[model samples]
Each structure stands twice: as structure tokens, then as C-alpha cells.
Target: MDPDLPSSSLAVVLVRARNPLNVGAAARAMSNFGVKDLRVVGDYLQPLEAARSAIDAAPVLASAQAFSSVAEAIADCTLVYGTTALGDRDLHHPVDVLRDAPSHVRQNPGRTAILFGSEKTGLSNDELSHCHRLLTIPMARGGVSMNLGQAVAVCLYELHRDAPAQRNLPEPAAAATADDLDRFESLLRETLTAAEYDRRFPGNMGANETRELVRRLGLTSADTTVWMGMLRQVLWKLRQAGR
Candidate 1:
């Protein structure tokens, strides 16, 4: 374990995971890597008993928090990374190779959450919407999707590996929390709508572009506040002009 890395600052969030065994295995991996926080979104059967597979990680499983939605699960995390296989899906979030993500995560000063989806379908577009970035584990051509447990182990191992050397790196600025980013997005959307930007494009194209733009910005806490204030002022001006 890296003396400089606080296990509590990293959270492993399982979204709509159907198998309790896989969940337990993930917890076990977290224990191996010294990451202490575990969060589950959605329900699973007999979580407590199945978590016995966590071995010595039973305490980690025991302390896991449950939420009804992904947004709720990682609300406080400053950085949210969603894992995906990139199968026949349009990726709006910027993709980060799994091997490189750990070092980027290590530099961040705020809490980070790594989200993994269910075994069968993986993360849906709605769940992906809550993430700031996407990560994919590299494999051979035509390789089968990695098992949930194994994927968790590999990702956490990368994060834990060579932590001591990274300890000396300069700390990154405090990034915006998921909730803060959400608020900024909401305000930006409202401003766009107030300015009738949505009317120019058919369907949700405007809103979707707005979301992608926001995610790509990778705003810090201060950036979020500034954007929110600016958007709100624009919205007010739009309303005043309309009146």
C-alpha cells in the first residue's frame, strides 16, 4: 500500500450488478489493493451471504453502500470513470486506456469513483452519462470480454502498482464533484434552452452536445462555479430580453 495514497479516497462502484459472487470478488480485489470504499447501485440477491466469497475482504463488503441510481452512488466523487467494452456503442465521454488511468487518478486531490457495470449488458447510456471519462481494459483481437472479477483486479492492481514512486508527484487541483458538475450542466442546459438553442436542432442533439462539451472540459471546482454563475447570468439576460 502506498503511504501517500488514502484508500478511502477511491471508491469502487458497481452499477446494476446482478451476481453477488462477482460483487464479492470485486470487494476482495479492492481489499488486495488497499481501496476501502465500495458502493453498489441497484439491488442484488443475498448480498451479505454471497459476499462471504470476499474472503478477508468481508469487512469491505459489509461496509459497502447501496444506492438506487449511479448518480446517487458517486454524487460526492470528484472524478468518475466508467468502464466499458466499447461494443457497438457511441462513446461520448473521452476514453482513457486502463493502464494510464491510475496515474491520472493518483494526481487528483479529490475523491474518485471507478464504475463497473453488470456482467451481461455492461453500462447503459444513461449510466455512462454520469461519468466524466470512460476506461477500457486492452485485450487481444477477438478476445472475450473479461470477467467482472478479473477486470476489477486488473484495474485496481494498476492503481496500486508503483504507488510509492508516484507519491512525489505534485497534487492536482481539486476537481469538481459529480454533483457540482451536474449542477453546472443543468444550468448550462437551461441557459441554452432559454436562448432557444434547442429549437435550432431537432430531437436532443443540442442537449447531448452540451453534455459532451461539459464532460470534455474536465472542469475543476472553481471552473464549475464560474461556469454556473456565467450561465445563470446569461439565462437571466435571456429571460429579461424575452420579457
Candidate 2:
């Protein structure tokens, strides 16, 4: 993983992933490739919590963002690719084999999102419509399908495999970041303390670890403000209960 490039402009978006184990596995893959951004499009929040609980999952999973829809999830991304195994369904968008897709992904200097559908159904036609293109991992047999977790790992590996040479391409626009992530960290710490999480799980995670967790979220300045507000509200409610 190249610390300098950091792949800050790249995000992995999971759509309606029903299995918590698969979510955790996908996050672990993102961690392996140094892709810090992970977005999930689903109404259920349990998978996110379960994934975060995985012992092997990195801070990437911990900071993963949730959205109610694919459009909302990929809103910040300038380019979007949907992954598919290729079946009887008609694919409207151009398809790129997994290995060759990385070049096009690197072509965009803005944020790029790769969407992975659920373990059972794969991406629906409506979902695929939002994608600029589709990516498929070549299989040994025409009909064999890859597991959701394994597919994520393979795509991430392909994206990261050629990073050194791809860096020569135009640099992506600077990603929006929180006020150095300090303000968000401070608010988060205060909220955690108010909720007595620190007392209950003493030394479970330290101040530095908390800071790193917030940093990994890769929130823009606007996102930080929203988080700050939410934390403050939580703190207010906690204090009210203590009264």
C-alpha cells in the first residue's frame, strides 16, 4: 500500500449486502489494499455493526459510511463502476474485464466508486444504470460465480497492483478532509466519554486510536460539521439522562 497516494479518491460501495460475514470480509480486503473509503447502500445497519466487530477488520470497516440508496452512496464520486459476473441478463453499459478495468479507473482524477451488489442477486438493472461501466472478473468456467467477499478482494487487488505506474497519471483533485480531523476527533472523544463508553471499556481503545479511527473515515469538511452536530446532540441526550 502506498501511503503517499493512499487511494483516497477510490471507494468501494456495497449494495444491499445481506450477510454480515461478507461485509466484514469485504472490509478486510479494503484494508489489505489501503483503500480507506467503504460505502454501503442499504436500509439495514446491522451488517455495518457486525463488520465493525470483526477482529480482523481494520479501521476501514469501523469508519465505513452507510447510505439508503446507491445514488446517495456514490454522490461524491465522479466515476462509478458496477461489478458483475455476467449472466443471462442484458448489460446496457460497456463491460471491462477485471484486469483491464484498472486503467480506466485511474483515468479519472476525481473520486471513483466501484459498486458491488448483494451475495444473492448481484446488481439489478436499475442499479447498473447508475454505473458508468461494468466490471467482471473472468472465470475458469462460464457459469461459475465468485463470492461477494472474494470478488471485492480480487477487484481491490487489481486496482492496487499497478499503483506505482499509474501514479504517473494526472493526480486526482485533493480529497476534502476534516479540519485535519482534529475537531471531529475531539467531538467524538467527548461523546464517548459522555456515554460512559470510556469507563465501561477502559483501555479498549486509547485516544490515539480514536484519532486514527476518525482520520480513516476520510470525511470532507462538510461531513465533519455534520458529524460534529450529531455528536453534540448525542452528548446532550446523554447528559439529560444523567440528570
Candidate 3:
């Protein structure tokens, strides 16, 4: 099945990447696929060189939180996926990465951190145990290992391919916005004027614009009612406070 929330419940855990350019490139790849977070163990982004490498993904680098050890890096993640080329060890699945891709990511997630080891050894066995399972890139024999950044990019893209596109947050409920309220008040005034009501408008200004704003914002019924209450409060003030 396709992933539900997308934004990849995925995070890349790079242990001693050993190259600023690779880290930056990985950050860029993370940003590209909407991976949720990253955790790097060992010295990382020492001089912000990774941010420069991230290109337009500077925000990803800037916002990337850090950790000291592999266990610490993954402590908060509920499902942990590890990547490895040397599967000579005792792993349940010998050489398949995509077999149960979506379930492994979505089945368990307070967060899911996909671990990538150093540029040289991939993940050490100690790091491997921390993971719930493995995500292996299928390759023909004699294929050179994937570049670190490219490896992360491929894994994240595969995991999130079917998930929905997400923005930082849902547009704050339109009703909760001052901008929406202001437009609605303006519309109430204009609608009254257009019906030969508020004389101050004369030619009836701000009505069309206000209505358009409300419509464009996709205001809900609840939003209209809230605005109506606000207008009532304003009208009560117009009674001159029992003067």
C-alpha cells in the first residue's frame, strides 16, 4: 500500500560521513524527497560546508538537529531502517531492500530513522542491531557501491514515492485568521451599502473585494458565523453604550 502521510516518515542517520560535500548533498536529497529529519553521529557539518553543498536546501542543514552516538540518534525513532551492502552477517533477508518497503516505514512510527553508515563500511553490525530491519539497494554483481548522497536519495525517494505532498502545516484554519475576519467585516459593510444601506459607501466599495477574499480563502460555515458574531459586537458598540 501507498504511504499515508508522506513527508517520508524517513530520516537518514549518517555515521561519520567523513565528507562535508556528501553530507550537504544528502541534506539536499532529504529536502528533495520530503524526508522528515536527519541525525548524524560523529563530527558533522564542522564548518557549515554541508549547508553550502546543500544548495537551495540550506534550511534543511540549518534545521538539522545533531546527536553524539548511533543509539542516541535513534532513541526517539520508533521504526529504524538500516542500509548495508555487506549482508554477510545474520540478517533475516539476505539481499532485498524493496520487498516490504512501505510497511517497514509506516507500520511503526513515532518516527522512523533510516540509518546510513560511513562512506567506507556502510553500517557496522553494532549500528545494524539498532535497526528494526534493512533497506538494501538491489544491484547486479560487480556494481560499484552507491555514493553516500545518492544512496540516501534513492532510499528516501522509494519510501516516499506514494505519499502525499506536504507543506509545513495545514493553512491555519481560515476562521482563526485576522485577515479573514477583516475581509468579512469589509464585506458586511459593502453588502449593506450595495443594498442602499450604509450611505458612507455611496458607490459601495470593499464589498466585491471582501467577498472575493472570503471565497478564495475557502471560508467555512463556521467562519461566516464567527464573523457574524464579530459584526454584532461592533453593532452593540454603535448603540453608544446606553448613553
Candidate 4:
């Protein structure tokens, strides 16, 4: 949570948003929370101007870089989070940012970006795929959802609450991320195939089961690398033994 580094490490990305006012408002909100970099993805900034919202934080808007796709905007970032409303995306876990934000940022420091989609349709599943995790603010169920500015404010508020961050996390001596769990799933599936574990079912294990079981372990980045390393060794050892 090193304050200076924290501010620099995180950014907000708006993807194909059609509202100019919301764009301006979001940039203003981000600056208020000590975030200086805002990357907007669209053909250009016309919609942002139409919203008439970010005028006060004009500098942020002035320098905002526009990208054609989400990947280019977030590619350099090591940790990326997307905002989502869907519950059926089985490969990723649905985490409440309010309860999970602090720990997540503390653990994964570097160029990080949180994404918001267009006002009309929200983020696509493919756009979300680029993110390692998802963030959403809870609201009373109804036809209304928070406007883009409001959403930005709330997220920054939570992010800035324990202001001027100091990196305070356990630095997991052993663990893995959802991505690592994904790779593990592949490895396990291959092993199961080789061992004929699928003969009984003739298909394969459900992905939800894989995600849930690995997520239960809360593996750190380091933990995943180590675990994969060990897995390779164990497999090689078995091969040598058989020979």
C-alpha cells in the first residue's frame, strides 16, 4: 500500500462507453481518489465531451489516451479486474469488491486497471476474459443501475478509504491465482486422460468443480509457479520410474 506507488500502480479503463458526461465524471472521480491515469477505449472522445461531466478534471481528460481495444489498454498491466453483472461465468469467481478490494490490490501491485463497459450494453464476456478478476458494487435490485460517474466514485471511494496505501499483505509463501488453477485444470485433465479417469464418465470433470476446488486454496502467484514446477518434477519422476 505504498501510497505513491499505489496511486501509480492502479488505473481505470472505460471501454466503448457512449456517454460523454459519464466519461468526464469518471475521470474527475478518479483524480479525486489520487488516480492520475485514465484510459478510455473508443474511436475517440466525442461521447465524453457530450456528457459535459469531466470539465472540472479537464487535465485528466486532456491527457487521456484512447485505445481501439481493451487488450491494448491493459496489456502491460499484470493485474486486471473487470466489472460484471453476470453470475454464470463458471471459469471465474464472483467476488464482492467491497470485501475483497483491499487484499487484492495489496497482493497484486503493478500497473492495474479496472474496466467499465459502454452504458447501453455493459462489458462483453470476451472483454471480461482479459481480466483476472471481476468487481461489482451491490445495489438494490430494480431497473436502475448506477450511472458511470456514480460507479467510478464508489469504486475509488473504497479504494481510497484506507488512503495513502502501505503494502500490507501476507506475501503468500505458497498459493496460485485463478489463471494458475486454470493451467492446473489442463494438467489434471491430461493426467486423468492418460490414466483413463474419464473412462467411467467418458466426458470430463465440470469446470466449476475445478475452479471451486482450486479457488478454495487461494493460491498466490509464487505458489502457483512453485506448484507447477513440482508437478513437472513429479511427472518426470514417474516416467523415470516406469522406465
Q: Candidate 3 lDDT, tens digit per residue, 140-203? A: 7423467999998888777776665565667665444565566566656744544445566545
Please, what are the lDDT tens digits per residue for candidate 2 over residues 46-74? 88888788777678887899999999999
**What is residue 222's positional error in candidate 1, in angstroms?**
62
105 in model 3: Cα distance from truth in Å?
1.0
Candidate 4 local lDDT, residue 150: 85
Score residue 196 of candidate 2 by CA lDDT: 84
Instruction: Show model 3 residue runs off by greater than 4 Å.
Output: 1-3, 6-8, 43-57, 92-96, 142-144, 164-243
The positional error of residue 12 in candidate 4, measured at the CA in angstroms, is: 0.6
True-vs-predicted CA distance for residue 184, candidate 3, Å: 59
User: Per-residue lDDT for 1-243 in model 1, tens only?
Assistant: 454664547999988777778888898898878888898888554553466545555578878888888989998998999998876688798999887887668777889999998888888899999999999988784224778989999988887776666347877889998889878988877887888877886465466776777888889998889878888889999999999
lDDT of 1: 0.82
Count of backbone clashes, every candidate in sequence: 0, 0, 1, 13
Model 4, 1-243: lDDT tens digits are 355435557878999988777888887787777787788888776875664444465567776778889999997898888876544445465555554775677677577788988887778878888988878776675234568888888888887786644567765465565677889767766665555566876544666665576677777777777777776766666666667
* lDDT of residue 225 for candidate 4: 76
lDDT of each: 0.82, 0.83, 0.68, 0.73
Better of 2 and 3 by lDDT: 2
